[model samples]
Structure formats: structure tokens, C-alpha cells
Target: MASRPRPPPPAEEQVGQSLSLGEFQNVQSLSLSAARMILHAMINHRQKGSKDGSIAMPETETLNKTLDYLELFARFKDQETTQSVENILGNYDELDTFEKSQLASLCCVEVDEAKTLIPSLANKISDADLKDLLDQIIAKRQFMDS
Candidate 1:
């Protein structure tokens, strides 16, 4: 009888400690912070618009770009980072100055914040990458309850 073939290792099991170019390239697509910021911005922005003439939904382009980035990140989750979003961001080279500035403005959060995000988030997200933010907020809630 022929021997059984082995299955490939999971993404979390991939070799090496640092990010390769392939890894970095894979991550640019999605960002939790970016999505959350966009969502929040849309909500806040809509609230400011006058109710008079016409009501427009959040800008389609904003949603599209944010979703594109997030979906990309989500897709890569299984193929990389052991499906850990924190690992993905942690190992990457980070966003550029313009991107960073845009992110900072959108999130009112710094890149350092990504460093502390929990790995439980992995690929799931909506408008902003709030996995970390949400986790942190929850942690605070526990502290407050105590």
C-alpha cells in the first residue's frame, strides 16, 4: 500500500521569526485600524451633514478602499501569520509616512498601538481594524468593574 501524503503546515506554523517580502506584501491589503477609522468617520461625518436637501451615505470610495485593504488582510490570514492579525502587523515594515499620517488622523491612534493588539482578532473586521482597540477597551472594562 502507498504511504499517506502529509498535509501542509498551517500559516502559524510557517518557518522563520521575521517577515519576508512576501509577508509584507501580503499585509498591505488590510488594516483593522484603517477600517475602524473609516467606519467611525462615516458615522461622525453623516451626523454633521445637514438634514435639509439630500442625505448621502458615507463616500463609496472610502468604504471601497477600506474594505479592499481589510479584505486583503483577511484573505492573507490563513496563508500567513498563523491567522493572527497581531503577528501580521507586528512583523511588517509598517505604513509609510503619508499612510501613517492618514491612519493617525483617521484613528487618532499611533502605530505603536498595533504592537499591543491581541492576536485573537486574526482576519475578522468591518470598517476599522478595531480588534486591538476593542480588546483593549474590553480589558479596561474589566479593570473598571474591579
Candidate 2:
């Protein structure tokens, strides 16, 4: 028999209600840092004259782009958009790939700060892909904490 479809994921308001202002700020900082690193890597790659094609930084603040990416990333946690979001991330190969562990260490968060995030996040998100992404983040946090 065909299995049942999952209910639509919580609305952003629902998700937002679950998190505090501090959590949102933390996520924004993390997302911005990741985006900055990716853009910086793209700049380095272009300077190095690699032929893979260039990823252009929009004439926008780094924070804006980072917020855009974070919004897109949240869609991945929605069942409807998961595959499309994954495809976009997979096809967009401009940034140099870093192993999750390496990425985590580079995030430079304090150990206690890292430790507090996992449970708060896990309680709110229901999507599998987001959970996996969160796990990778937690792993990175654990490494940094160490």
C-alpha cells in the first residue's frame, strides 16, 4: 500500500514562535559567517583563474545575501521544496567544499554556546534534511567545543 503523505511543515510563524530572539540572532550570525566564507572563497578562486565559472556576489550587503541563503535553507526543511533546494545547492558549485568537521571548527563558537544550541534546534525542526543539516552543525559545534 502507498504510505501517507506528511502534513505540511509548520508555518514560519509557528517555527518562529518556538525560538527566542537570541536563537534567531545566533542563526543569522552563523549563516552570515558561512556565506562570507563562501563568497571569500569565490573571490580567491577567481583571483586564482580557475575555469569552473564565477559566482557573482550581488551588489548587496553580506548580511542580506546571508539572510537570503538562510531563507532558502529553511525551505529545504519543507517537504515540498526539499528536492529543489538540494538540487540548487548541489548544482551551485562555486564555493570550495569543506568537510563538516572542518567547517565546524572554523565556525569559532564557544563550547558552551555550541552545546546550548542543539536541543533547542532539534525540538523545533521536523524535516529530515534540516535535521541532518543540524546534525552536521552540531558535530561542528562539538568539534569547536573541544
Candidate 3:
């Protein structure tokens, strides 16, 4: 014989508000959807009711300054040096403070080599000025570390 359908449980005997695994996954999915909605709202707010829906890139002065500094490095050096410098500075914004300090340390080696080759640098700088420049380099390094 066919069995009768089970009666619906009373409201108090129904599942409590506690979440199960599947319910938790649903909640996570909803949270992600909510975050996307919030981001959409923000972009819309930034657009200021434009009909075409084109979002403008935010101004990035710091990135421009960093690129300008990289370009200055490129101008002073050979083509290969410029390419290498570009590769190093391309992701400048991604580097942390320690990585920046490490880059400075690498530059100190070049400064040391420059000091050694100063006498051979066409003798444009006088001995006193070179001495002062070396002193300044030392002072700058100390000041940066502090």
C-alpha cells in the first residue's frame, strides 16, 4: 500500500536559524554578490549619472612622478640601460619599503664605483668638490637610514 505523506513539522520544531555547510556556502556567495553590488554602486556614484556608462580612470600623480623619474634615468643612460631600468621600475608601485631600501643599497655600489672612477671622469670636477660630493653621499645615506 502507498504510505501517507508526512505532516509538515510545526514552526517551532522546524530548522533553527543556524547555518549548515550548504547554507554557509550560500551565505558566502551572497556576501560576494553584495560586495560586487557595493562596488557597482561606487562606480556608478563616481560616474555621476552619465548615460554612456564609461568610468574614468582616477588621477595618479604619484605614478606619473615615478614614471618621470624612470624616464630621467633612461635619458642619462644607453639604450640597453634604459630598457633594464624600465623593467626594474615598471612595477615600482608594487614594491614594499624593504625592496626600495634594497634598491638603494644596490645603487650605493654604483656610487662607490663612481667615486673610484672620478679622477678619470675627464677631470671636470675639482678635488675639493669631489670630496664634498663624497661627503654628501655619505650624509645622505645616513640620513635615509635614520
Report the C-alpha lDDT of model 1 over 55-131, residue by residue, as the tens digit. 75656786778666755442222222222433333432433322322222233233244433322222233225544
Cα lDDT tens digits for candidate 3, 65-105: 64455444322123333234334433444332232222323
lDDT of 2 by residue, 49-131 (tens): 54455554444586567656654543122322333333333432431122222223333244333324432333333445444
State the lDDT at 11 in candidate 3: 39
Return the candidate ranking by TM-score, descending. Answer: 1, 2, 3
Worst 10 residues of 3 by lDDT: 26-35
In model 2, where is the ten-residue run with the lowest total lDDT?
94-103
Residue 134 in model 3: shift from native, Å?
1.7
lDDT of 1 at 106: 31
Give the winner by TM-score: 1 or 3: 1
Stretches of model 2 off by over 4 angstroms after superposition: 1-30, 50-136
- For model 3, the stretches where C-alpha displacement exceeds 4 angstroms are 1-112, 115-120
- CA-lDDT, candidates in order: 0.40, 0.39, 0.38
Report the error of model 1 at residue 40, Å: 2.1
Question: lDDT of candidate 1 vs native?
Answer: 0.40
TM-score of each: 0.25, 0.24, 0.24
RMSD of each: 15.2, 15.2, 22.9
